[model samples]
Target: MPAADLTRAALSAARVWLVGGGKMGGALLTGWLDHGVAPDNVTVIDPGLDQGPHGVRLAADPAAPLAEGPAPDVLLLAVKPQVMDSVLPAYRALGGGPTVVLSVAAGRLIAGFETAFGPGTPVVRSIPNTPAAVHRGMTVACANGHVTDTARATCEALLGAVGDIAWVTDEALIDAVTAVSGSGPAYVFWLTECMTQAGIDGGLPADLAARIARATVCGAGALMDASPEDPATLRRNVTSPNGTTAAALEVLMQESGGLGPLMSRAVAAATQRSQDLAG
Candidate 1:
């Protein structure tokens, strides 16, 4: 599929204040530029980080004050949740004024931002996985009632600049989202690890086992993406009656102690952790 231009003129026209310049923030800034948003329109406010993209402004904190210039239409909050209380209120001026605050800080509720940024601030809580760095990210977002239609669109555009996005009506669902896509990549990585180990146990050379496992996992994903049929159908197509693949499936598909139940319990635990973190 062709690259999406979800930002439209939203990014180009808005004055953006980015609070973090770490990996995820950097990836998003790069995404805005790649999507043709003018470099001059964005500003970075990470004190610990040095320079940002070529033409964008970078300073230890707000260059002047949050209210000083352009009245930033969007304030991208990509900082850690733990330090948010101390670092976030400083940006309240932006929030109190016009900027729609979009936060990727996991576990921080929209109400938390509302409290810090002051009541009535339009706040968006988002969860983006590690794949965001490669622009294949799966981001899920939910906004407070204060978020205007235009503000929501702009937030979507900014996030869509990096990768695909999905919005949920219920903020509670975010915990489940966190359990699934937010941590899903790590599960995939762990699968590769297990598969590689299994191959080694079967007497394959370590290096060759790693390569085969890696390729098989990635190739399967690619095929899934390209095909119209469901995953179950795809799996059936690769399995022959009483064949090697069937033999493997018999074990893997076992109801009582197989991958299915294991993954279910894993996701449940992760969801509970996410909820705890939110608390």
Candidate 2:
């Protein structure tokens, strides 16, 4: 078997301990199970969580003795950034060993995890969007120096179960990644809202406008995903030289007062906020 296949097989049989059974965590758990990771090999630790998927053990406290068994191969942290500091200490015993700590919390830096888990611990900090619930999200991640090639492959396989994954050697790029892919889904939703409102104003009924707007946005995204052509090429293929799209493009493609500048400002603001949160 190929090395990649062997790594995947290992991950499929690997023991996983998921911290925080929130939206993202649940999504990841579902994805992993779907990708062939045994449900019996996974444990979810969340105080507020009532239950987990069938065959998956649930623990309310990370520090408490586990009726399940020993430490996991991968300890994935999905808690909110606000509660991460308080929650991290409980899992300190699970770290700095064979376990690789993969975190999906925004604004939490790799350095902080190293400080909490010790310098030799392998840590992967990632930012993933909400779309992972449906398994179409984009995730960008970075790892500390302790992570080995095998550990990186394991992280990639786990992350790949949800959606696409990208890595950055320089961890600082994660702030920008958070701004673009992390917050980008909200921007797309807002665009759908704007399109719906505009359609309503242009004589369509509110419900009709909303439905069409939502469908158009989703359809366009699907096309972008399926097409071999670049987005610019696909966009140009739809737009005529002197047509409705061109007319709209005239306003939107303006040098200064256009979507380009507006989106740049938005991304910049989000990037700054990400940095501030990390601090």
Candidate 3:
């Protein structure tokens, strides 16, 4: 089916049972509610939920009866990776249905879900960043072979509730996703921090420098997102003959090895570590 049709199907029929009410889960819940998903359709099961917005049902334990009705159409596992085993049993009754099981826990794989649930259970694993808390998250998801087209569409819809979604057939690539977008936000924040320090060194006021650094990066990212042109083209448009930006680019793109190679190494290291964790 077309991606658009899939999206529509998802929005029309998605009934989500979110297991964690932490930052990512709360962000997704907010996005869904904001996007017209009936709060009555969402059942959040989180022991730590001290407070929740109106319309959605919150439960401190999974054994509690759902206020909406029966089991959810989709079960979203958002709890921490370490506590997944403890949380799985509570939602196992839903595993027998046509429901799609979706997880945003880093390093958890499809096999792990199958073990916790039952064989042939449809599963979609994703790596989402904290930016998801603000409805700007980038999610990379992959479904187990047991997942059908409808199941995949359902998973996509649940993920789209938060932000952008990308599908991958190869589960191994999920590790790379973990390294890139999953951890990518931290890299951006680090850049902001370094830029602020540079401004400080350049003798700008501390507060002004911090604001400038943040606004520059945020604006640059928004521009990149809005533009049809490639990032390299956009970057070149900002550079001029012997200009300060060019000088900085020259150092950043040095021939021997520069930020590009250094970042590549960092991503590779992170990817390997994700694989290790999954193992």
Candidate 4:
């Protein structure tokens, strides 16, 4: 099978109302605009945000209300999870219509959105990682049974603006998705930190070590992204007979307590945490 071309999807005609304008919201809005979505077609509702993408309207919250004016084709919820319960009800008025609510907020579930929007309403729960800011995000989304094919496609189009998207049929897998990709960036950053410190310990200057660590991680990631071969194949390609890379991999790939086992445990812990939060 071939990879789907998410960028080819259209959001040019959809009326979008974003309910938050913080980091993630800004990333999504910027990516959409960069992909040529009309500025006038988008509106942002965030009380704290005094500005947003050029030509996009910024509406104040609570008193001004999201339900006001014409309803949007998609109403995106990008607010903090802690405040979701307090803020979601207000957006309910915008639902039960043509609007398909798409949530990028971690830990918020589709059933919760359906409850707020009333039963049988289209809702999409997505977990988009921080790479979205760079327009290379990987988003995993799943929709409620109420969501039609058209609504799902619109959600995909809207999200695709930020980067690639993976549509899941089972919502249960979303917690794992969140743990893997949603929290994956932090793990990669931590790896960079560890590598940099190791280099400094090995007598390299602090500045040089840091730069090398950053570049190596980033360059390797770029290679992995562009390559058709799997990561294991790439790793093998870099390993020479009785080489330094092989020696390092010996320590890192040890069966019992190596990167593979440790990463499995780490992802499992993150996945469990996500499931707990969802519960």
Candidate 5:
């Protein structure tokens, strides 16, 4: 899409109300603000917001009617899964128009939204990681049948304000998305921790090992993003016959059950948990 088109699609009719202003909501709000979205067009409805963003109104309760503002063009539901029911009734009162509701709560489906907002309300379910705070997150979205092409575009634009957006036609894939990118950052952090411990075990000072491990992961990820080649090609380029990297790979990518299988199992377990939560 053209840059102007993308921007226009993203912010058009863009009066947005965020129902929760926790970490993920704050990340998205900051991103949108950084992208030149007028703070006046955004409202945060978090009771816990100690201080409001400049120019944006902060409300302690979204349960109350939208006090004199334009009906929201987009409603962002960012509360935890368990509290959606409690918080949804107030938002639902404003759903009779062309509003598109986008939710980031894990394990909730479009059907759950339909239950809350009545059928025919445009709903988009998304999974976004905490990395979004830095504008490097990956967000995956799925639209219910009620959502129009324009609504999808709008949703994409809103998510793109933070980082990348990928749409999935199959809603079932969203559980996998939750397992992967949604929960994947924690996994990567664990990997960093493990590598740092290994480095320390290999005789490096603890602080030095941690710093090296962190930088290595960040730098390698940046390099991978910059490179045109696939990761396998990149790995092959770094591995010499009988080299140290190759030796490590022998254990990580072993024949029977190695990192690949372990990761597959882990992702499957997470996907199953997401399904259970949705249930």
Candidate 6:
């Protein structure tokens, strides 16, 4: 079998325990099912979620019964960072050995899981954005020393089901990654909002402004994804020497008080916040 097929087959056979079934968790569940993971082999635990997809077991809480079955092959943590501390203890018993713990919670570190689940636990700390709901997300992951190659593949397969995946040896880089792709979708959404408002201020109808702004952002993102050329090249391709795009680019590309420096500052702030949360 091809490697991708083999990975999906392995994922299908693995018992996956999804610890939170909110938006991100739900997205991952959909991805997993689409990638051939058996619904019967997956379990979702969330007090807020009254029901889950058909054939998948759902639990209101991590009751004693949850620990009754064979240890899960993969324990995916998708809870918010604010509540992860309290949630981690409840599932501590599920860690270690064959069961790799994959976390999507922003700013939660592998050491925290290792400490909560035991030092021997294999923990993969990852940052994924909301775009995963549409299978266009970008995720960056770093694994602890205990994660075996096989366990890493399982984690990779699960993440790949949603979107693109990249691995890094330096866990510190994850904070930067979190600042970039993890929080990038929000920036794009804000850009759309700004464009919409700008159009309205420039005399366009409110509804039309919103429609065009939304379409432009979405379409540009799609174009970038489908293009072989780098973003800079694609950008330059549309910018005539003295045209409208160039006029805008002159301001945005300015060394001081420009989009580039502003974006750098924003990313730096986010990176710092990520580091703070990890503490």
> Top model by lDDT, which number?
6
Q: How are the candidates ranked when ordered by lDDT, highest leading?
A: 6, 2, 5, 4, 1, 3
* Candidate whose TM-score is highest: 6
**Least accurate stretch of 10 residues (summed lDDT) in model 5?**
62-71
Stretches of candidate 2 above 4 Å error?
2-7, 65-68
> Could you give candidate 5's per-residue lDDT for residues 20-138 as a string of tens digits?
99999999998888776778888899999978789987888864537676778789999999998888988777765678999999999999888888867888999999899999999
Clashes counted in candidate 4 amount to 0
Give one digit per residue, the lDDT tens place, for model 3 in 194-213.
99999999999999999999
How many steric overlaps are in each model, in order? Answer: 0, 0, 0, 0, 0, 0
Estimate every model's Cα lDDT from 0 to 1.
Answer: 0.87, 0.89, 0.85, 0.87, 0.88, 0.90
> What TM-score, over all chains together, does every model reach?
0.94, 0.96, 0.93, 0.95, 0.96, 0.97
Q: Candidate 1 residues 127-189, lDDT tens each?
A: 998888988888999988888988887888888878889999999999999999999999999
Q: How well does candidate 5 match the true structure in TM-score terms?
A: 0.96
lDDT of 6 by residue, 155-265 (tens): 898998899999999999999999999999889999999999999999999999999999999999889989999999999999999999999999998999999999999
lDDT of 2 by residue, 136-180 (tens): 989998988889888888888888888999999999999999999
Q: List per-candidate RMSD values in Å.
A: 2.2, 1.5, 2.1, 2.3, 1.5, 1.1
> Which regions of candidate 1 fall more than 4 Å away from where they truly are?
1-6, 63-67
RMSD of 3: 2.1
Task: Please report, as a residue range, the 10-residue window in candidate 2 with the lowest summed lDDT.
Answer: 62-71
**Residue pairs that clash (backbone atoms under 3 angstroms), model 5:** none
In lDDT terms, how accurate is model 4? 0.87
lDDT for model 5 comes to: 0.88
Candidate 4 minimal-lDDT segment of 10 residues: 1-10
Error of 4 at 271 (Å): 0.4
